[model samples]
Target: MDIQLLTRKIPIGISQCALGEPVRYNGGHKHSKVCTQLLGRCFDYVPLCPEVAIGLGVPRQPIRLVKSSPAADAEVRVIGVEDKNLDVTEPLMEYADSVVPALEQVRGYIFMQNSPSCGLRGVRRYLPNDHGIDSEGVGIFAQRLREHFPHLPMEEVGRLNNSEIRENFLTRVFAYDAWFRYVEDGQDAPRAGRVIEFYSAYKYLLLAHHQQKTRELGQLVSNARALEPREFAHQVRGGIMEILAHPASRKDRTNALMHVQGHLKDYLDKEETAELTRLIEEYRLGLKPVSAVLTLLRHYLPRSPHQFIHSQLLLAAEPAEMGFCDFH
Candidate 1:
């Protein structure tokens, strides 16, 4: 059976300010066009500002994470930049706990960068003497959310500027949604057979991401009969997500594309085979985009009668409009 990816609007969490809301401490917003224009087309954002949620008024004093001592494992506090005595660390973390239930429906999240309350990483921390240390803090609210949903596809809006990171994040988000749609959300008890079927769609995609880990995951799937259905599903989902956590390197992607190309060669004429092989080689050498090769491969996909190739998610995982082809 061909696995269908979610095409409906995916509900995801985002910082209110990133959505152009003036929810910042200074009554300004760091609006992102990528979030508003690009991702907004596919995602329904549930926006929130933890500071605002905790009753901190808009235009309130800015807060920063502060290390009480210079020690490596010092206690960090979210304190007012102007008035160090004003602390809201607990409130920020508390808001994350309270809001998680509402956010349970969201499959992914995009955080605002450099926020003491929401940055996923690399937020600045301050020393007692007012010295600042860069890239030393995780936002209090983001930290709590990580603890609550370790597998969620979370990223800072700033990092989405990179093509590979943006594509990888969206890939994970789609796969996460696909899991619920195909396996997790089924009315029947989760079946090992169903989970394996789901895994089939992702096989090539996983190979593109990490060949070694993908092989290990295959081993796990081979033993799915030994484990309970729910446990098997959980293990596979975790494995799939973990493998896709990093952007696939060009070398690995070329390898995967070549493997895919092998399946079609048997059905193509000599000229067709040479053309396809040339494009794949060009893509491997970075002389042409992967899309070029993928387009030709897809054009020939109908000639062959392999059900597995027809079911491969790597071919149809991304929507054309997302401009994922332009990324590489």
Candidate 2:
């Protein structure tokens, strides 16, 4: 199936500021062309601003994560840096809790970086003395979002500047959407069978991400018959997310590419095999993108097609969604 034809717009969540909204504390927007011009073409962004949604108006005082107590389980509070007594942590958390239920339809989210309210990671936390900041804090709102939807693909827009990270995020977004659609479409199928089929379709894609985890997931799927329906689906989704969390190394990707090459080996002559091998080596060496070899492989797909190879999302999850080939 042409996955791009499956939908024109995939629902996604985004920080309002990242979408060029003037929702920042300083009444500014950290507009991302990647999100706005590139990804925006395919994503239906549900823009959110936790600070604003919590009744903190534009041009409000900046909030910082401050360690409030020295106790073992000390709570961090989002308080005004200028006026330490002005705490807004409770309100922000409450707002996140209230808004998350409405975001269930979103397949993925892009957070603004270094924001105390929206940064996905490395947001600075201030010590009570105000002498220094620790980089261990995650944005309060991002934390709650993760807790609510652990399997959803969420990344900070800053990190998407890296080609591999960008590619991985796009892959996960499309895969998550595809998985959701698969479950929705197969509502009447035996649960175990649906789980198996879903995993099967994503097998090669999983292999490209992580081989050991993919094998572990396959084992987990085999045991699905013994587990409850919801439990089985949860396990499968968790395993897939864990596998995709690690960026695919060149070695691992080469292994997967070679696996695909094996599928077309019988059809290619010696010269063709050498040329394909050279292209794969070039990709492994970073001289060429994986799309180059995949494009060649796809050109030959019609000559000798296999159901498994053709169904692999690794080949093309949503080529036209956002010009993903350019990311490679």
Candidate 3:
């Protein structure tokens, strides 16, 4: 596939603070160069600040999650730090609900870490007595959005700093966007045929993430006619996103790469085959990066005329845009 397809700006949601906006409680920005400079190249950001959206002005009082009782699952509220009486948990959730329609266009969302309103997870939670837990809370607004858009790809700016995590997140984002464009948004009604084709394209990509789940999904797609079209589509979509959610392990990736190599075995000479196998083993042993194997595969790709081999997303340059070239 032409890598240029991914160059078309993908619309994604982001915390305004990540974009260098002064939307935080202290009227400061937690500007992330990664969000604004790197990922921004392909993503057209739909910036949002739940705190500011909920009528909390810039330089507003800071809020923290406070547990009503010291229980395993206590009712946590976003309470004003200094003014104990002010609680905006419900308002934050309500604001998240209100933005659902607008956010529907976003394939993924990047949240600000450690935020009371926008943190994806691991925000600080405090006991009513004011003692704080190290990290045991999810921001109210982020929680609400997760509940509403369960399958939408979400990540924290802090987490995206890691190359592997960033690549995995982008892979999910592109796959999510690909599903809607190719299968769900087809001119005709979505059918088993389109779903199968879509799955075929992502087969090795999924296998690299989770082998058992990928095989199970293969069976699900095989029996697509047994379920209603909409239901089948939903199941397939959920499965694909879930599989891609796990970062592709080096061992599993080597396995997927070997599968790709199998397709080209008949097309390569003895020396070429041995060279490819050596590189794959080196990658499996961490002696080399996955890119080395991929580079060798691309050299052999043109010699193989199998369309299916060519169709694999794993072989395409498009994934390189997601930092797959640097994936270790």
Candidate 4:
């Protein structure tokens, strides 16, 4: 087996604190072993602390938003004032806004959870009129990142704790990186060969994951030769987005596993095949698709180099935050 084929490189942006940097509100860090250990090998990480960059020094004054609504039911934004006090946020927003343009290199970002300044989801906001709430705000920098590059895959470190969420995130990240490499990264023309090579490797994988759009996307790329470059470019990019919109789901993943099982009929013993078939059925019934398919693949893939490589390709192509382990 070629060692290089076993390694896949994905570019990711992570919150500095999650990478073990002391950039949290209290001069601490929320370390994620999954990111530092399991995923680190497969991904080339780019770490950032938006709060730190926005001039909020470690152990600085805690900031919160007094939302316009007294009921605390709307989305939150940070406000510098509390109890009719002073405001101080222009510098922060200015810095946050400036940092986003520099993140064009990142295919995905991992954010801190529940941070008033960096939370990717559900940070709190207070009502200054004493409506009595301060925990439902969006981190200013995270919000800006989403607004700037909605296409890039992103997730919170906390979300990675769930195996399925981790798997989904990793799947999107890897696919997004491939896309940037094949379509967006600098070359003026789409390299039809590389795109097709990737698609061919992923064709069954895409079908298994229930990405009907991805299958269509493969066909579109395969059929692009007759069109002019400018014409094909728009169609191809749009097709890629359409595929991305449908993150691999459990039902799709089960079908993918079953497809692989069908391909293995000539290889595994009757009893072994029966066991795997049962697991695939369990996945269809909602018994965790990642572990189920992986159990079968791990059992049979080692027996054939071709099957092994194909399995690895399907795995590494998945988003890290989508599942429990690095398929790569």
**TM-scores of all predicted structures:** 0.92, 0.90, 0.93, 0.69
> Which lDDT tens digits does candidate 2 get at residues 180-274?
77764445543667667778777777888899989989988988878888888888988887887788787888888898889889889999999
Worst ten in a row by lDDT for model 4: 1-10
Q: Candidate 2: where are CA atoms >4 Å away?
A: 1-4, 69-73, 185-190, 303-305, 317-328
Q: What is the C-alpha local distance difference test score of each model?
A: 0.86, 0.81, 0.86, 0.66
Candidate 1: misplaced stretches above 4 Å?
5-7, 186-189, 321-328
- Clashing residue pairs in candidate 2 are none
Ranking by TM-score: 3, 1, 2, 4
Model 2 residue 76 CA deviation (Å) reads 1.2
Best by TM-score: 3
Tens digit per residue, CA lDDT, model 3, 241-319: 9999988888888889999999999999999999999999999999997877887898889998887888788765235
- Colliding pairs, model 1: none
Against the true structure, candidate 2 reaches a TM-score of: 0.90
Pairs of colliding residues, candidate 3:
none
